[model samples]
Target: MNSSRHYVIDFDSTFTQVEALDVLGEISLENQPDKDERLQELKSLTDRGMGGELALRESLSLRLDLLKANKNHLAPLIDVLKGKISTSFVRNEAFFEENSDHIYIVSNGFKEFIVPIVKELGIKEENVFANTFVFDDEGKIIGFDKENVLSSNNGKVEQLKALDLKGDVYVIGDGYTDYEIKAAGLANKFYAFTENIERDKVTEKADHITPSLDEFLYVHKMNKAISYPKNRIKVLLLENVHPDALQIMKNEGYNVSLQTGAMDEDELAEQIKDVSVLGIRSKTQLTKKVLDNANRLIAVGAFCIGTNQIDLEECLKKGIAVFNAPYSNTRSVVELAIGEIILLMRNLPDKIAKMHEGNWDKSASHSYEVRGKKLGIVGYGNIGAQLSVMAESIGFDVYYYDLVEKLALGNATKCNSLKELLQTVDIVSLHVDGRKENKNLIGEKQFKEMKDGVIFLNLSRGHVVDIEALKNNINSGKVNGAGIDVFPSEPKTNKENFESSLKGLPNVILTPHIGGSTEEAQENIGNFVPGKIIEYINTGSTTNSVNFPNLQLPILENAHRLIHIHHNKPGIIAHINRVLAANDINIVGQHLKTNETIGYVITDIDKAYNIEVVKELKEIKDTIKFRILY
Candidate 1:
């Protein structure tokens, strides 16, 4: 509550999430036949005014004429605005109530609707200066007061000049009129509020562009609901994960930077020095060297299913939580495997190529239907199990083999060994994970056991299948046709060329690891992985984290929570408790969990503790990281 500075805030698209006049048109023109067209025109006028393309006076005149709104529409518009408050503003309602004396709502809108919205926020009615609506004898609106300063162009600058005070002034808004006050040298600074809308023209003239009200409070070092502002946390997203994911992280107020392709270890090390959250798909490799350079890295979001590309051991030691979408894209990979099985069995790739070459032999030489063919699924996990059910539904007798015991789905049989399943089936589809032992799981010895003319598929990890062995088997006619999505090695980006020994084979179907590359799967992964990353960052709840021990924490209420990560050794918790005891800090609650390598502890204490307690906690021996949550 800086008493030396007066705060002037905007109304439409700043305090509320929408333009008040645009919404007023919707309420008043609900039953009109051309309601949509009128709404479009109203929105255009609002944008033009906010963007400085039209004067505020003219924009308001045209919009009011089109709205035809009367006194009857103001109440409903007020009610709609109550529900449309900006999310950032709604969370910081206390800030407005505490600083009611110095805060003012100055806008080009009418006081009829603005008063009701700001009244609940503890804003004094006299402090709220805006245009007053003039009503007719029958309560139908005619026009605004012509003498009101807010009804004219550059009205905010004129209005602020008339209310001359002896303190520094600051303006926060989304419209060009808000910046006009500062341009005239009436205010010390102007902040372009982009929580709901960002006018480029206004932002270019602003001293600072705040993504939300929280950002404004954070920069001023005011007491806010969050212990730290999200805008300060640097997030780097690479490998072109999904637009939905990028938008979600940006809306969360993270300082996000995106790169469309993967980066090598040295390149990533240089870029990851200050990044708090790192996002990637399958291409980028998070090795020990890369993780060592990430001094501020707290979490890594793998947008794809596998975590083999990331170094889990180093992540655990460094107190970095890793999250991956394990099941969101399972159905996508299963569908691809089923489709590939049918395509390779019917020999459709060869026939399609022949047709494209202008040759129409039209003979069923080696084609076969998948109705009675035997289907063997290797490594029956989430994708493999769903594939088993789908393959069985299409009339194939399914068999699966895994090192770990898994229940058979439908009427599918479980094989005792890889040898038994390989020798027994007409088609072998690999669906294993990316563990080191699974590399080259299907090689020369395993392929020799498969039935001759068998249709084969590998939609799993690239290193799981030996490509040369499969090519040799195809040449020997032991395997008639094969489908492979993953490869032994892939280029870092789509711009690079792909070379493989399986290329130019007669009936081979070679795809560039597109088993789970569907739009739907990417969207689901986009929704899932970022949520986990945000959860871990905000509440220290590593419920779905792969490297950290699972901990699901409740929301903090009326207290400050201290999160401490350290090595899993004796007397770690005792040392933490001793530090709190010596500081005379009263503990509300405590939680502790540990894996083989690291320990995580959360301590909730009363807010009255001195700030020096945080310094004492970090000085504990073997402490990896410490943070405070409110």
Candidate 2:
């Protein structure tokens, strides 16, 4: 085993999820007349160059010429690439950070975008051997650095030879340029990295083949565990979360079990006893008892906006992270709210019902357009603010009231109190959260304060509005029409009998809580939330965790990582270090962060210690949990 082995890795489709040139071409020629033709040409050129069928320099030149990009496009493209890194590489970023000195990004991709992306992973600029772009005075990319070795055929091989000295050189990439390193006798081994995409021609030439970076490290006995497997992790998705989420989890090689409806808490506890990852929407509750029975559960993903059904504090105490799609479904809810407002204001529900029953009576006596109507919005968050803009565009004066001071969008007005908003607006829509304080935010008094013939809507929490008060107002003709989406005591399954006080009313529209049930919204939630859960389980990242201390730790190389979660108290890190020091363990790197109630410390040390070190770490004061990952 060589401690100083040089790791020369490819960039496009190896380090990133997409080919940089293809992405740049898309961004550059977007909406242009020649976009389709130019994009296809660039993609074909990229494939040829990557598959070793064309000279690297000639292929790169033609692609660069096809890109009608400017300097301004690089920053945004870099941002996108930063997010599109191969999932395996992203989860194992700590390893690159710890071994920055021996890591080389030998790419035919340009340095302008690669520099910013790899720099975030701690890879230094000098270690990045790639071609530079020659730009015009107007910042438009005109040509490439023709003199650079990376521009020529077998450029990675030439660069590896130029470096001249090392213990050993290992090449890991998806393309043939990387395979050339081994053919030139400069690399000790060539491992095909096909986690993002596979090229059979390149794969056939490799000494070793792996789907993920973690697998390569596993083969070398350097990884703590193969978190990035080809597809063996078990996931249980309930409550009819979008099939796209299931497909994503399966695409990453996970075995999945999916169901369409919420389950009883007792049944969930029994079912999730051995589940590794559990996903649910709003109804299925992950109670403390349920979590206690989940022996192998490492992560929970909520496919909806609110995670109130999940016992987050219990999950956090048990070392489980909770993730949700808070932003993905916001627009769906807003669109539904706007549509329902229009239907309610014009008295369409009753008129449609009469026509359905074969009535010819038609009148405009109780009907009205949305223009000049006042819409009072409660809880000015994502959905509320969006609905405000659309309502205003349709000529409705929008007034919003939130406990927190929110910036008004368009000509929407901010009211001093919910009471003031109810007094002025002809329509009231609820969009509050599931916090305990908001249980009955809109009850009898609030309903009594609204103007006569006012329309009412509740697409927020089930109990946010008093259903009894709303039904009574509709009966009294004080509320002309109402659209109710959620109920405080709704049935668990769609087939179960539903009983609501607002039902059987002429102008009341009762929907089955499909406010955010659009295909686009569910698909977005399915993809976004599962990725976060996978990232947390793989990298110990708490960046977007709902109930854990957030910490972004660097990757560990040839070292053991100790992730210590404890009470937020002083001297925890010092105590942790002392215990390691007493056991003759040398610390390589450490990161510690603390919130009001919890402290998270990540310590990386040389792997020459005894098991007693872990025992001693468990004895540290205020230590809530301790585990070693190497």
Candidate 3:
């Protein structure tokens, strides 16, 4: 708190998020037939006045005449303005309360509206310099006080000179008149406040363009609630993950942008150059080249279930945490598996095709019920386990096999090996993951081991099963009917055509990969994945991170939290503590977790410290990434 430094802030579009006169016009002209036209005029006049195109006196006169607002409108207008305070200002309320003596509300607006709003923030009423609204005998608006210097052109500069604010005056505002104070040599610096609005003419003349009040406080090393503002963290969400995800990130105050579809490797690499957080579905690939170009990336969120499209090993080496929705869409994929099994078992694809061609083949030639069928589920993961229980309830004897041992659910039985499950079941549904070892796990040899005329389904990864072998098996009648939702090759967008060997086969149900594509499943995923990423970012909690060690961090309070990700080697944690000890940084609490390749350590220390400590910590050997969470 530097007592010599004075802060002069504007009211409309700077302290509050809206123009005052425009709101007043809406309130007073509510019953008027020409309310829309009057509101438009009020907005236009405000822009011209703020742009320095119109005199302040003339602007105020015309706006008041247009408003025709009585004393009653001022009270309601104050309530609305209170709620409309700039988000950044609301976050730093403590700073304003502590520095009330040095902070002033200097605007060309009215004191009746400005004082009430600033009063709640601990601003002194005498420090507020603005015009006074004169009223008639009936309490209707008539005019303003002409004697006040704020009602004239260049009023802010004239008013500041009269007050003679001492030492290093800083002006934060969105209008050209606010910039006039600095231009007239009354203020030291002019910051163009753009949290609510950005005027080109005003920002072009500013010494600094502050996106939020937090940015200004951060630069000045003031005692603020946040060490780093969320508005500085750039989040790029691609493939149109979900609207809920977008809203969630925005509510967290991040600079979030959304792209409708996934980008190719080259396009993604360029777009990720400066992005701090990247969100995508399965279509976007996070290759080595793309990750290498991401100079500022901190986390990658796989909004879908599988992380096969991302290079997990590379992400680990780069100290980037990766997350995915492992169980959010499980029920959706399981329900789709059951529906597809019934459709393929009844040979409905061929029958439905014939019906479309006007051939009324009302014959149950090969249609069979699935009540007593054996349903074999490969890879007993979330989707697999859920499918097992659901299939058992549908009167099918469920059998499952996985590389790792898993407990059987309900009356379902676990197979000892893949060969054993293939030989026994009538319907084989692949619910495996996207590991490289699982690619082409089912080829011609495995298909041959399955019972003849068996039904097959692959709703998992595209490359898990050899498509050519499955196509030959279906054609030879060894597989009576099949449902293949995934393939080795697919189109990136819906506008492109898809071609596969399984297509045009008799009794084969070839669907585009849409196993988990339900409105409910998408919404569930939208609610879960972004929330996890937000948790990891806000509290350094990596409980469900795929590529990082799991640590369920508690919320940080009354201290600064520092996170360091480095190569997993001996003496890394010891060296970090040594550096902190040398800088006199008292560690309040500390947590360390490590994997085979990377070590993550979070340290909480006293809030008071030098910024130079960060540079020393980064200079340590084997350091990958470092960040401060305050």
Candidate 4:
């Protein structure tokens, strides 16, 4: 051992966002007859253990005994735990890796779970001083090892003292035992790590309270400070964003508030005032007046592919960067389109509906095979293109039409116009972008031209098609079956009554815009867009931005970076340098870019400058926003 300063981090609620035993009970006793009761009991046991209200062994033994689990649940439990790690830890893997020799996990959580997750961070097995599980001959969990130090009260302190550890030791945790480490002089300082949960008894006596790993790293100056306290930067994620996206923003240290569904413009406007980062799906509309209320909004993350819901021009004028995951959910949407096509062709909807109603009508009147049928795809974009390749691979003839020419994938052919595509194919699926010009692009005239009994699917914008015309076609048997994912207007919440023209119509599949609702797709989008937003926040990057001028700058190590956004007028760069020169803060290097409306500049300066320099930059004319980053 190097005999240097050490950091003993907690496992549950501190290093990870959830208590291990609680999650374990949820998974292990998932199908048990007393699931709810056992879960509550396990939670109580965890509370008592962390509060130091009971001997650690008693709590561990009791909770473990209540577990009806065997060794089989460990693998899947670890997978779930992998995603639940504290956001700070996920973002700062390098810090833990580089300082693995000095960092340790001291907790009453089981080694079976904790060891596997933290080991991925380069923490050694021997250094992890957590309780170990004892299993019976049948692999059922019996209890924990009675001799493990963490099984006893004040185990972390006892273990650290036994190690005869040298130098300053900091115990970063969220439980009473973590504080006891310092109370016993086993550690120099106790930092109450509360990225997940906070306990008052432990927090009251802590030398420092850290909400995130980045906060701790920032306070020690071991790492450069981010733009702001992540927790202080308010993020309003609307329209039921995936928990993963919310988790990512939380990981970056942003204060995040979530609304499970979309809100109306007035309610959204009311919620926009204090938000710095606003994330929404396709439904929440951000009008000019709504943008006006977002006084502190710096970025908007369109969690879906389309940005039509937001006021892009207004966001640009406000120096706010807008980002979207145009390709992240493409496969998901395409797969849904393919599945809907197959269902429609096989008359599966009617068959399933009749089956549900106890009607045994197994006739092959409307049913047909998708193979050897021509699938006309409108707007050959990400989803349409992917669907083309997959459809052709499964023996369907593919034809696509777009305003702009796109290279045909596989044996798929491109039609010159939407008319030719409609006249020729057996089925037509729309996948166009939701720009204003695309509104009513398909109406009665387009429907009139399609062959009778032609299947139709619209996975794009609701306004792109005239719903009344679609209902007419289905009524006249001009279209055999229709699958409509998007609607011109949808209810703000799940409890609201739905009103649609095609409701209760025969062979019609009217869905609530769930084209990309798969677990994999949401997870991908949740990971993709927030990373871009955080990139723009931390490194002044706008690589995938929709509104702002595109620019990306790497981290300026051991230096302060000045980010200035201004109106795209002449002499801004010169004015900025003049201000820097007057303040005697030499600019080591700078990067500048401009578009039609704004100028963005990233200047690295000597870290020795004071607040006056920052004040002068903010006072400059036409400065939309000025931030000092370290």
Candidate 3 versus truth, CA RMSD in Å, comes to 3.3
The alpha-carbon RMSD values of the candidates against the true structure, listed in the order shown, are 2.4, 10.1, 3.3, 9.3
Cα lDDT of model 2 by residue, 162-265, tens digit? 99856888899999989988998998999998877889999999999877787787677653244335443579999888888988887876779999889898
Q: Could you give the candidate ranking by lDDT, starting with the highest?
A: 3, 1, 4, 2
Q: Who wins the lDDT comparison?
A: 3
Backbone collisions counted per model: 0, 5, 0, 2
How high is each candidate's TM-score? Answer: 0.93, 0.65, 0.89, 0.71
Considering only N, C-alpha and C atoms within 3 Å, which residue pairs clash in candidate 3?
A: none
lDDT of 1 by residue, 1-630 (tens): 778879999999998899998999999999999999999999999999888899888888898889888888988999999898888887777788888899989999989988888887778998999998888887877788989999989899889988885598889999999999999999999999998888889999999999888888888877677777788799999998889999999988899999999998899999999999999998899999999899999999999888889999999999999999999999999998888888888889999999999999797888888998899999899899999999999899999998999999999999999999999999999989899998899899999999989899988899998888989999999999999898878999999999999999988889988888999999999999999999887788999898899999888877778899999989988988898889877889999999999999998888545568788889889999988765
Q: How close is candidate 3 to the true structure, as a TM-score?
A: 0.89
Report every candidate's CA lDDT: 0.90, 0.85, 0.91, 0.87
The better-scoring model by TM-score among 2 and 3 is 3
Best by TM-score: 1
Worst 10 residues of 2 by lDDT: 223-232
TM-score of 4: 0.71
Q: Is candidate 2 or candidate 4 better by lDDT?
A: 4
- Residues 1-630, model 3: lDDT tens digits: 898999999999999999988988989999999999989999999999999999889999999998989999999999898999888898788889989999999988999999999887889998898889899999999999999999999888888988898789999999999999999999999999988888999999999988899899988989777778788899999887889999998888789999987799999899999899999998888999999999999998998899999999999999999999999889989998999889988889998999999988887888989999999999999999999889988899999999898999999999999999999999999999999998899999999999999999999998999888888899899999888878777777787799887779999888878888888888988889889888989899998899999999999877889999999999999999999999888999999999999999999998576768999999889999998877
